[model samples]
Target: MHDDAHAAGVTRAGAAFAARRAELRMTVQDVVDSGALSKSALVNFENGRTWPRDGNRDKLERLVGLEEGALTSLYEQGAGMSRQDQTEGLVRAGAAFAKRRDDLNITQVEVAEQKIMSVQALIAFEKGRSWPREMRRAELERLVRWPPGTLASLRNAAATPSPDLDGVSAEPPADPSTLMLDAVKLALTSALDKLKALPADDAPTFIAEARPVMASLRSLQALASRAVRANIGSVSAVQTLEDITACFEDLMGRVAAHPAASLGQKLYVARRKRHLNVQEVADILDMPATTVAAVEADEQELSDDYRERVEQLIRTLTFLKL
Candidate 1:
């Protein structure tokens, strides 16, 4: 218990340095630019449970205005440890920042409304003392960017402004078949974005997630591609569009209903940790770029060669993560 208290106090000082320095009107970007350190490196230092030394302290002091004794105390308290431990300060800072918002003189409701989070949740986050994880800190970090900040992204989610689904009826017949088209189109767009964002080393996990969904998407693409190739009459094209939509609902149903979701989640976790790119996996299998469309839907049957390629991609990811 004594040791835990000591560790918490050390952690708290690191937290205090970040909170106080920023309170003194210094911005993180200011520190990053002046110190010529990568934003992440500075983030790591300010977020450390202990302070960084070996000249980093000098740079930080120049940015935030700390005296020698204060710097030494903070550094000794928070400097060396696991990244997970270091990152906790960011979480703690986020929570602490929220707690003090009232002293900064803002109402919880206003903060919640601004951040697109429930007031209750805002309360929980500020009060919760459990370990902080990346996802949890992400929103908090965004909020802390502005003194008494809020996340625009979360607010935007709330303001998602309904899309014009009326146009959807023109392309697909209004029925259960319509669902398939909708799901496929959504997944297709998602996969394309993922491919564009990730590189080879960053692709495997995404590919694994897409592997099952991709197959179905490809089959749809193949069918859609075939429709264009067949030169179906303009009038008949409407029916083709409707047929495509049917295929979409049929495929998504399977993907969402069963083991597919579990598999995709496992793959997503692997991809996130390994930083693997699905595009690389597709290339390895000699798949075309259109394959990106298929992956998000998990539509591919995966030829034996492709399956082996996927296995190799997974192996590569495991090694990278290590």
Candidate 2:
């Protein structure tokens, strides 16, 4: 399958090269004289006798004012298969990525937002209509919750046939606990905010107010733990949920960790890490937008109680699952 496709690509590329050169009224010698390619190599390529190597192919593309890989795309198209088909491993990997995202109920818009790509570009990459650049691919891998280069391994398998799929499941079971991790984190952060708002001297009032929040956290943790024991998902995910549950349990009675060297720096980092702009954070916290900005800029003095509350929120944000 691979060889047949490759041969077709070479023949098609050769014909395309010849046609484009003719359209431009350029001769074989004219190409060679321009230092784009050698006489023998140019003849072989134009005659469909041989394919050009990387360097020569690049030169040919430049000679014709074609973008890099434009000729290769033509080759792929003429081969009667997509670049995705020729690279089944990549297809499989992409399928796995899609399945994982679906399992999490994560939207493509969310993935694109986190990956910092346009929605159309992310959609094209996911559909195998186009490939992403290296850094972008890495970002996508992270967004999909895979280890780095897990999908990149597909590139190495491009020349081979697809692996067996009958024994493998495309949409494997995912840890149900993992699905709730983000929600739990946000809930815990909200709880911390409420706790921070109470007067430090009012222990009874704090406990009374905190009881419902703690109960909710305990319930979520129990659910997550039950999912793990039931083997409802990946072991790694189960372990992660368990670990985070334990961390939150420990944090329930603990005070917030120290802020950054400055209050403003801490505020800035916390908001950015949560991907919230100042106005959004203000809206959520019920603070004025100008006050949020002023606090972040260190231009306005905040009361000690308000500053402490913000610090607790910042510490809670630190525990956020990214």
Candidate 3:
């Protein structure tokens, strides 16, 4: 019965993935060509016959533009009682809290205004998408007129099953560097999403925001490259970093062609590309830091004197090959 339930969950997740692929207008061949998975594996995955291992799972998620863990969360819904059961238990607990609040004629807004949490966060908790943090859990219990240990007790009851009890070996903790790389990937994905949302008419604002993200990506790429050269990380980590760099460069090229990007924005992006800080460029230009900042902000007309200084700074940056 448990195995059948697990198969059903996997099938549901597979159906979702297949639907997303169709929505994106991608073919199974396209996914195979991208090397995210082989044809047979892709067929099996989309047919709900199997789950991809972690590394392939990450690659597949990236290829489909899904948020990290989108598929895994679905697969967990039926793989075992450990996660799914715990989730359902916690959800029930949240519903009970909601009922209690309703019985008292209290609004979610009223509870949030008392500083227990924001309305969105309270809503997430009530919906069982997440639990309140430890520091806030007690306050939440009190706000809902529950006993002091009520929240903690609920959380404990919903915790993952012990390995000893389940006869399943516990997974080892993740490497610190691997965890950091995962975070970088998430940040890059978020930046890419934000970049896509910017209107073409707002080129100045877009470039201003994008340049910082570009700088951060370059820094992370350098670090990851060094790690790869030193054989300090896994093959998957190296590949993930390379994928992030490619995504960043692709978006940058699209943004770079925007005709409405101002001269100030152009120079600001160039300065960032050269890895020069604003203060450093200001010192070289013999101008105040505020003046450099003003130019980059593109908020006012530049005086002839200021314009000449800016032009000179640009020439210097170019000549130095920086």
Candidate 4:
């Protein structure tokens, strides 16, 4: 077994990084502004949610006063995997992919020749150095004969916040559908923000995850269909408003059901369902209007006790169909 210091260093690499960064008085933006790391990559790595790619790995080690390969070693030690499989949450998934391919005696070149992905891409994926896009990930999972979402589950398991991490908060975990929606939101938003960088054909794959955007786009298509049916007659503004309202309400209901929805959305939806105003709910919870507004907007993360009270109120109201 490893000694205590080494074990602590490996298991708490993120905390170590954070503490070192604090010593240097460096904010997250500071590290990003140095042009050494992308914001997304830094956030995930520093949060212990991902392994750093090779280039970033080197830079981060230098910045954090670690020996060459020290961070990598720490991560591997923590992950209980070899260098080849130490990638973020892809450790098990990558191992499974490699094992399945090897058992069939299929070479990486042969897999690439099948036109699934480039040889280099396959190599990187197997080494856990990079992630495939959702489409490619799904295809790869299928090729490996794994169930849909198996790799996704592994990734989520890797990225899940450590309860010991300070300043990170949690809600009671939601149902599977809600968790899926939250993942969809993160993945879709990240992809959409880089839309211009992607090819035209790649756009459609992300659309399914962008439910609200898709809902709006579908509404427009429906309106066009109705107009075509009417032979270009003028549309009714009232009908349009009603249709829009229905779409919005439907969207809100779905959002409310999503686990990632801010506490505010849940509160708003629950109160609205009971035909109660915000003030009424606020009074019932005995919280100030400002606090209620802040919670809904996610401007504040509540203390454990306070959050428990709010959760209790929500449970009571939900049980009452209010």
Which candidate gets the maximum TM-score versus the true structure? 1
Cα misplacement distance, residue 114 of candidate 2 (Å): 1.9
Residue ranges of candidate 3 with Cα displaced over 4 Å = 1-176, 186-257, 272-280, 288-304, 315-322
lDDT of 4 by residue, 1-68 (tens): 34543333343455345544533324454456445587787756655565567788787765544578
What TM-score does candidate 2 reach?
0.27
Judged by lDDT against the true structure, how good is candidate 3? 0.63
The lowest-lDDT stretch of 10 consecutive residues in candidate 1 is: 148-157
Residue-pair clashes, model 4 = 1
TM-score for each model = 0.30, 0.27, 0.29, 0.28
Worst 10 residues of 4 by lDDT: 212-221
For each candidate, the alpha-carbon lDDT, in order, equals 0.46, 0.58, 0.63, 0.54
Clashes of 2: 0
Supply the global lDDT for candidate 1.
0.46
lDDT of 2: 0.58
lDDT for 60 in candidate 1 is: 65
> In model 2, which runs have C-alpha deviations exceeding 4 angstroms?
1-90, 158-322
TM-score of 1: 0.30
Model 3 superposed RMSD (Cα): 15.5
Candidate 3 lDDT over 1-322, as tens digits, reads 4776667556546656765564333545556755679988987886658878889989888766578998887666535545566567558667877888899888999877665688998788888887664335545665665654465345334433345656655887666565666665676676567656655634556655555455445445654554465556478667867876776556555554566655565567567678888779878877655456546645345779868877776666657753
Worst 10 residues of 3 by lDDT: 152-161
For each of the candidates, the C-alpha root-mean-square deviation to the true structure, in angstroms, is 21.3, 21.4, 15.5, 23.3
Rank list by TM-score: 1, 3, 4, 2
